[model samples]
Target: MRLTGPVLLVASLTLGLGCSAAQAAESGSSSPTPSTTVTIPPDTTDSGGLSPEEVQRQVARAEILRQQILATSDDMAAAMTKVEEAAKKANAALQAYSEASTEGRDAREKAKTQADIADALQERLDQARSELREWAVSAYTQGGPLAEQLGYLDALSKEASEASNPLQDLNYLTDNRIRSVDDIRQVAVAQKLASMNAEAELGKAEAAEAKAKKAKLKAQGFVQQQQSALDELRTAHAEHVTEAGPLAGLLLGTGDADAIAASERLTDALAASNVSIKDLRLTPCTDASGVFPNGQIPPSNLCPMVGSSDEFLVPDAAAAFNAMSKAYAKDSGQLLCVTDGYRSYAEQVAVKAARGPWAATPGTSEHGLGRAVDLCGGVQDYSAPAHLWLVQNAALFGWFHPDWAAQGGRLPEPWHWEYAG
Candidate 1:
């Protein structure tokens, strides 16, 4: 069956849920969801094919896909609800139609029986009239209209002339007239009841059948629309996944930080001012991965560092380290080995478990703040060539061999290095 106007509109809107950079479905409206613009940082020149604009573009694209997924989810839920409601209505209508059909069938059968009874009563009344007509004619032939319209006694005598008893003659005449009139009245009443039962019941049955058919059609149309929506949703998700890889650097950074400082700043600002999110201050993300658990850590001075490890350091330190590493690699024909660079709180706990008393407690470690590294060359022995080179010329690179780590100092660690930057 053909779909109605309102059902067609729902189908069209379900098909229109796609956007250029985003996807959203407006209930009862066919307008498209608009794309949002974001300003990304300029390229850091050395980023491995991941320029700021490229990253931001990818992020915005992903956001659009995210919106579509959410919209589709809502669409799926609503479709299911519509189908359910439609099914419910259809079931009720079908039940009503069934009841009406049965009632109509029973009513028709009763009407047919009443019609037969009415015919029989009519035949008997006709026979009684014929008998009376003969008597009326006899009365007119014997006398005239005057004699025919005379006393009941005279009429009775003519009707029951062959009766042996006078009382019997009168009783026979009276009974015939009374019984014939009652039969005529019964036939008319029965005919009227039969017509009411057949005609009224037939109309009800037809109307109920039409209502049930309409409800069934509506449910079927909704199911078809839902299936089409599901197909579109799957295709959109595949495209979203295919394009999300450009949002990060060449590699994912393992650096992790507590974000306590940023959290504290957020709390303090909220106490001082009403701290509207639209005008909130942000700190550069402390994590090398450039991600916070949620959007909870707003954007701050993010110093993305470019290197083979794909790690980010504090901005000044990361730039200086990059320069220093390039110089060092130039001289030695290989970069300095890093056993560990930045450690998240969880990583610190793991390291502490593996190296008792040697690993700093989680929050106290400088690595959590993206400022420390542990060297793996013979630098751990304090006498490696890599350490010797840094001792003499590392000052120019903003790196230093700290005093606390010097020989004979308390808790001396030969492999540790901190960036002054």
Candidate 2:
């Protein structure tokens, strides 16, 4: 009855339906609806039971992804725009050619225009093909079937494969995998469809290119060149339909690869763990020790980290931190001294009262998120070996020292590090 979360989405990936059909199916069925369709719901909809802020955040994220994709593909995207221009020119040329073939009115001038447009189109087709081919080859060679890169035939093949089976090489599915599968499958499908359209366009362009060459040689049937150009333009329009959708926001490359991988891992970990916004809201900042006024702290979603810190952290973040700690000890033969971990609102208030503004504000404290930790021993010193090692290695595990907490930072606390998970 609740048409929220990943159900309708996964159904869409698995079934492939229009947004309206999917919604209709979701609203109609009480049983698990294996509906087809993944319409992007409004960013903020009371129907989905999500707050406006959550919708805004989702939209913001999509916007950021779109920007990143376009930023990386600026040159290629610009080249692709020429396809549209070429399509327009081809239409014009075809009209001129048609007029030339008409009963007789100095047809030479119109024929010349058609030939000229064909020449321009051939040049553009060559450039677009070359650019796309390069990017596709790079993605295929580097990522194999898993690469998300969009380019030429390689991008096509990968999109098709990924669209169908995103979990191909992975061993098992996490909660995130199950829930995210549909949302991502839709993206992959959109990409796959786009690639198919592009393939068709490329084929038409190649054919037109050949015809254009012949026209140049004989300069005879300008009328034939006009027909070929018209056909290519039609294909370009079809390709544009796919292009105007998902590919605009998706980028497949290694530049942000680590961040992407970490995000997936974190999502899985969050799903598998017993963590929820509600549970976090119920947790106290610290065990009551009467160290602060009223001993009451804002509730937080903090879970205990494994192996070392008894300090609580948000579930996945704690896991990442623990993993980092293990690797750190193996590399350096020492355990980090954790003098402090998750702090309640009350605890933050107490610490700040004692330390003044030198401490982060209570609600603003990273410790409140259960992702911040305070180290003791030599690790707290900016020049200490432990701190130096952490700076070099922690990012590998999705942990980082905040710029504000680093040496020469506004606060300059070398003892602090936060899990980015």
Candidate 3:
């Protein structure tokens, strides 16, 4: 029987015989041959019914493919670095936009307050001038200052006849007329200053609004650039997968012992780079239309995990998580349990409503970006063995507990983890 793919890896490594056991079995042996009883095959012999020259060529081809895979891995690493830089730029732009927007709002409120103060001052100046004009008209009608003063006093006494304190009202009216006439020029100057200040504040508010709009546009441009970089990276990955897939198939299907050995080496190298044969068969996520602003990514745009929980994440993150989960299972004798992954926009809205301040706002969560997960099965407790193990090793798989989820954080959550890539 011809073994293939991962089973070949297991059979060779688990038995510690490489492909020799399979070779021996194919030779029509009745029972398993002991190492002591084994005889060396001829140097000219090649297993899988191939000539020695053909086997050598297959082995050479496999080595070439392995080298190509390493080159592709380097390309991917470079691409990932670019993606990270783009993300940083995008974040900086967003922060600028947020600060500009806040300043714009504050400036607008300041302008409104200043305008209201200016309007009140203008009204006060008008009222003072109107009273001064009436006083002047009374002085002209009465024919002299002394006569006008006596006339005003008589008018006031008539108005205060029903007052609770007629003497006090008369005294206040006499003091107010002198102060109003003296303060008229000061009120006019104050209103002019206020109007000028209001205009300045209005100009500042408009400038702030323009700055906010520019910041928003810059932030949007950065986001689009980041998305384009990601798309390019995905395209490069798909191309590499296409090239590596057939090479792997050609090497493994040949069943030549030397070729199989070389194929196994290629597999090991792929694993070392956090890649798998299955990756070569996966559908690339290329369509990112309408799946931005966090969350709202379609299922077809993400990679689904193996568990029944229906958890999913972005392609690179999902692959890392899968590799990490497998390692955890091997070391701990149990699969890593995930409580949450890749939240849709609608799901995020529901989560926000249900959890209130404990949950991130909709469209702003890292989970919405398909790079975070909430894990359980002893991983939720900071003191648990599983959590301890993760602390020691998760970063090796590109998963990390963010500082916000660390102990003593503002809202510590030991279960939350995110993919760095």
Per-model TM values vs. the true structure: 0.32, 0.30, 0.49
Candidate 1 wrongly placed segments (more than 4 Å)? 1-67, 101-113, 116-120, 142-164, 167-171, 192-421
> Highest TM-score, which number?
3
Q: How much is 50 displaced in model 1, in angstroms?
A: 11
Q: Write the per-residue lDDT of candidate 2 for residues 264-311, one digit (tens) a residue.
A: 332332222211110011222334321222223333445565445467
What TM-score does candidate 1 get on C-alpha atoms?
0.32
Inter-residue clash pairs, candidate 2 = 12-37, 17-36, 17-37, 280-300, 280-301, 285-344
List model 1 lDDT by residue over 1-421, tens digit each: 2333432343344223222112221232365355633333234222223445643544454455445545655655665465445433433333343344445545555556655665665676677668667766875687424532344446456655543554654577667667766765675576566555556655655665565455445434543443344455445444433332221111121011112222222223222221111111123334344433211222253354434454445655566666666666666766666676666677778888998887787666766666666776677877778876555435444455555666786778878876643
Q: Report the number of the highest-lDDT candidate.
A: 3
Q: Give each model's whole-structure lDDT.
A: 0.49, 0.48, 0.67
Deviating ranges (above 4 Å) for candidate 3: 1-59, 144-178, 221-225, 272-421
Question: Which one wins by TM-score: 1 or 3?
Answer: 3
Give the poorly placed runs of model 2, Cα more than 4 Å off. Answer: 1-301, 306-309
lDDT, candidate 2, at 284: 27
Worst lDDT window (10 residues) for model 2? Answer: 273-282
Q: After superposition, how far is residue 110 of candidate 1 from its true place, in Å?
A: 4.1
Q: Model 3 scores what on Cα lDDT?
A: 0.67
